[model samples]
Target chain A: MYGNSQFDGSAAFSGGGFMPSQAIPTADPSSPAKSREAQGLLPLTVKQIREVFQASDDKANFLIDGVSVNNVKLVGLLFEKTERVTDVSFVLDDGTGRIDCHRWVQESLDTKEMELLSNGTYIKVHGHLKGFQGVKQLVVYSVRRITDYNEIPNHVAECIYVHCYNTRTRKMQDAPQATGQLPNPAVNTPSKGYQPTSSNHSQFSVQPIVDGMKGIDKIVLNYIEQPSCIGKENGIHRAELAKQLNVPEHKIMEAISSLESEGLIYATVDEFHFKSTVNG
Target chain B: MDTSNPAAFVNAELLRMYVGRRVRAVIQVLRNDGGSIFGKSTDEQELVVKGHPPNPPTTFVEVIGIADSNRSIQAEIWTNFGDNFDVSSYNTICQLANGDFKHLFI
Candidate 1:
């Protein structure tokens, strides 16, 4: 339940991971071209960055959690600051692990930005990941000191969010094959219609869905499916549900009606109350 | 210093799990007495931080060191996290790093 969870938005966060990775058409002949295309900036912790492996044949590509990653970002304490004639480097630690990050001073702006960092200051680094003789380091493109402390936790949450979105969704995609269930085409047809056009990670990060329904519809359904909500005589009233979710009365009504039509939920006591059709 | 073992993020509760091991935490300074700091953990539990305070004492400080005891940390590295910080958010990070998302961290 959201009440005792570490993050109130974690339900929404995990929902993003449920989007079928197969939604992206992989059958296209342009597999190599698609793989070469730029991936969205991946938010990762230093520990996860260390776990990434370089592609066997190509030195350019990197993979984390069995998926390719690019343009990674992290927030950490700037522990060691080194300024050289050609480039400036820093050792950043975000508690999980430490990583060496460097930015080439190609112009005055680069030097100016790098000068703003000092040891013990928290900074956000946006850069590419590179492996130098089997050691991983971040090739810093942009670095900014974190003035607002909230960015620290926000970065951690984002890392976990992307981690789940990449790894969990991939597991779900591979689950049927691993279990010897060779592609249930009958059940997969309807879910294909709901796939988004863009495969960008950030686009679907907040859009949590349930049984092809989204937004308030999904939230209401999930709330009713909670262990406590099942098998109740009257179930939960629309007024109580709306009050609990802090949504307007009409929006709850809309979600209930939509969910009812989809057969995910049914009217239990009169038209105003509802419960999930799935049993306890 | 080959990183076979690394410091983990810990709050007051998790610090107990890492006794005599390396850990890191953000503490809101309650009192500073030159060599030692009396601070409150992100989870709002009191902790003694054994380290030198930064010049012009920051309200929030992150200490990376060994968890000496459940209620104390022996600081090796000190970072000034400025006067204002979102303690609740930091608390959430502590929970996630040690809880459901533990594998993502060291």
Candidate 2:
């Protein structure tokens, strides 16, 4: 039996489906490698593809407006088609810009798909972004001629929506969460170099409750744990907490109730105000 | 030869600014007279495309060429988009590509 194996025989474990917050790893889940693996195909324009910048010291980690992008879906006019012995290369022009794209000749099906496309054919390509000699290009996974004319406009709309989400909307939503994550046990210890003994003591006391909480609950707890909230005897008001989190009052109420049930927070002054049990 | 300058996506109105420059527009062919095409732009404005029109004109065609005037284009390329094209969606893209998101394009 492979009972002792790391992968084991957990046939029921659905990797792509929902998992409870507690089961999810609490560490920096958005590590560049992990986030890249989790990011699905980003619908992007040829201009955005050309504009992607190397985000980290590692040359391979590319980002479009701070959003990690790996696989991408593009719709454009196939301008030039060339067939080499092992790969088919073409240039795609989407009106915004043009970029070189290539697909490997792996099978008869690939060659057949390549044969269907010619110069000036509108096509949809799903591919990975790659850099060769400082020039960005696509290593295509699948290419299909766009039979439906609506797909062109649809692709444009999709790319704009994705662009806004990556550059503006998602960043606004993630700002508080990024600050909230600084107090994580894994990240807190090293930063408290001057007071290691006190940091370790607090870490041990807070680790269990912090480990089980996530998302809005973790954010609410972190806000309550702030020195300003903890120093006051009345704690912070529910309205203030809701405003700080930019979430609906009902959602804050739900998170507060869940945290209270777990004994991580306690009412102070009145039921309207709450403080973290560990630090307050 | 003209590959150095990218063809900007333009509507009947946007075409005015790019006079004598490369532009692309999808137009619903209203009439074809062999050497020229009289069509309606995605924005529903009339446009004259001077080039060899498609032998059997489709409902819609995308023309890429130099904007000769405010209402006319000297087409260098014509792509036959089959019948049943969505004009409204293309209209929205034209406005977005030239307006708020102009920086995204060349």
Candidate 3:
């Protein structure tokens, strides 16, 4: 019963009428046909993409192959509120020389894939095509962050290479390749002992150089409630300090540097000690 | 800038009150050689006029408390008629105030 030539990629059941095999027979008989279909679908590499387009009918589906996709949009929903997946949407670029994508849902999304979707995170998606709002798009059923060779399968690795190469070419076109040369000053002599810092510091002090500097008054007032942070013992690193105050690191550093220069605080390599009025 | 008009008088005082509360108000500076004047208040609050002018000029106007169906407090200002004014200046001053004070001036 097993060695029949008629089983050419299609399954014929024992029933008299032939049921066109909906999916490839796996070792487990209970697996859903949709899952099998998802596994069978091939992953498209980024290099193969020329453009992406939004499906007109289903705002969620995107057409990548230059053909109009009339289907539902693919969306992944997560129940757990995780930082990585919140407030993120992905656009799938099919290798067709366009940017075709769809906005699937209004509610916030959370998923494992979102963690890898951060800036500079690379990932691969495996999903089935679904039509939403008259557009055909991939609904990711499974996704994995791309890592070095050992982690990814061979086929997936090839796809990643193709994608990376295409992305590099596109980036090059956007920014001209630099020739890396020094400016020529054959006629004019280089200026000697030009101290630009004095003038620069004056202007910097007059205006708030940092984008999101919290006012010194506000900081002093708010610090009262958090008494544990009273002294230099609780001094946080520049990055951590910025995050706590919801300001940029450079701004915090600038504020500290200014206060230190003014003799208001004692500055060391890593921390600044707020001067106690009682000492005076 | 006709300070003679009662509406102009009320608006000028309201502007001072707004600024005292750190709220900004926009007023059109109209000059017909005499003085600058304003008409119409941005907010609606009752004016409690007390004491005559020029005798140390102490006037206190309380913003009448009127709660609407939505539970939002309404402020109304009262002024006598006949003052020529501009509305655009008041709108600008409201914007200059922080986002929190916009409703107060508005």
Candidate 4:
């Protein structure tokens, strides 16, 4: 009964709202995003997140644009504010709504990335929702400040496009069951601007920092520069690079440190977010 | 960034990001109801009152209150950029004094 709808990663890009764009050269057969899509952990937009908060019943799990999800991915402004309780929280404005993101500090883990975030910045956040004293909040998994302001509009458009795609797919899936007719293969085909999984608005304004690099480092640089815009709020995390490149996290970190020292790449938004000097 | 306590997006930045330092906004006047001219954000997320603000559209405004429902924010005009104000586009930000915007929504 669940054969067609088993969600065994066939719709990897569909669920996460991420398409395997040429921008992200995760050419490796075993990629983290692919695995996550197989696992069905899709991303949610901030506006959809607001709907999650509003539609929740006694802190219940909510659906984001027809997909039942607990995780969310949002892009927005990071405003600087004083520490209210000495606890680390980042307030984000994605134009649709304002959300507070919380990430617990692990003493054993490196928090240099967290320290890199500052106010008056644009950023991308990945995490889930939680309730604090009746107010809805986000418990973030990752946060990066943005450099390319262009990604702002692009991100918004992506959220809308993905939501529409998912909604259409679900409706198509449901129709077959309702009518007992064979599912239409054409229904799963790409929508307008859905080819190659690249965003319609991702024409990059910057280039990769490749002045001096070799082997994996060059490949990593190429991958990080995949996003149409790159800078403080628009750079890639070392871990993200690792997943996309199918490389070890340590390797990406090492490459990043070297590139940073050469002054070839710098943090346009904060320490964690990087942009090539050539782009500036 | 401490994630344990989530509260980094503060009120001050909201004014700047959503509104602006100069409080520049393209306010859509809904109607002029005698005493106070009613206006709102192009998205209708905010309710604005013209002439209620003292300064022209160039300076700053005070965030007075937000509705209990959290649907809107309320502020009194502190200043304006100029006496004459008009918004040409919906998304285009009309440069107003930071004080003219009372309550800012998304």
Q: For each candidate in the order shown, give its overall lDDT on alpha carbons.
A: 0.72, 0.74, 0.31, 0.45
Please write out the lDDT profile of model 3 over residues B7-77, one tens digit for every residue.
Answer: 11123334443321211122222211222122123443322221121221112211222222121222232
DockQ of each candidate relative to the true complex: 0.44, 0.34, 0.01, 0.06
Q: Against the hidden reference, what TM-scores do the models get?
A: 0.67, 0.65, 0.20, 0.37
DockQ of candidate 1 is 0.44
Candidate 3's C-alpha runs over 4 A off are A1-39, A46-88, A92-113, A149-280, B1-106
Residue A229 in candidate 4 has what lDDT? 34
The best-first sequence of candidates by DockQ reads 1, 2, 4, 3
lDDT of 2 by residue, A37-146 (tens): 33356688777777778765443467776656667788888977999989999988877778898899989999999999889888999887777667778888699999
Where does model 1 exceed 4 Å of error?
A1-29, A32-37, A175-249, A252-280, B1-5
Rank list by lDDT? 2, 1, 4, 3
**Candidate 3, lDDT over the whole model:** 0.31
Q: After superposition, how far is residue A275 of candidate 4 from its true place, in Å?
A: 39
Candidate 2, pairs of clashing residues = none
lDDT string, candidate 3, A83-138, tens digits: 42224345532211112232223243434345445422324455444445543334
Scored by lDDT, model 1 comes in at 0.72
How big is the positional error of residue B51 in model 2, measured in Å on the Cα after superposition?
1.2
Model 1 over residues A168-269: C-alpha lDDT tens digits? 555655532111111112222222212222433211321333534668998898788776887587788999999999999999999998777655578886
Q: Report how far residue A273 has shifted in candidate 2, in Å.
A: 33
Error of 3 at A3 (Å): 43
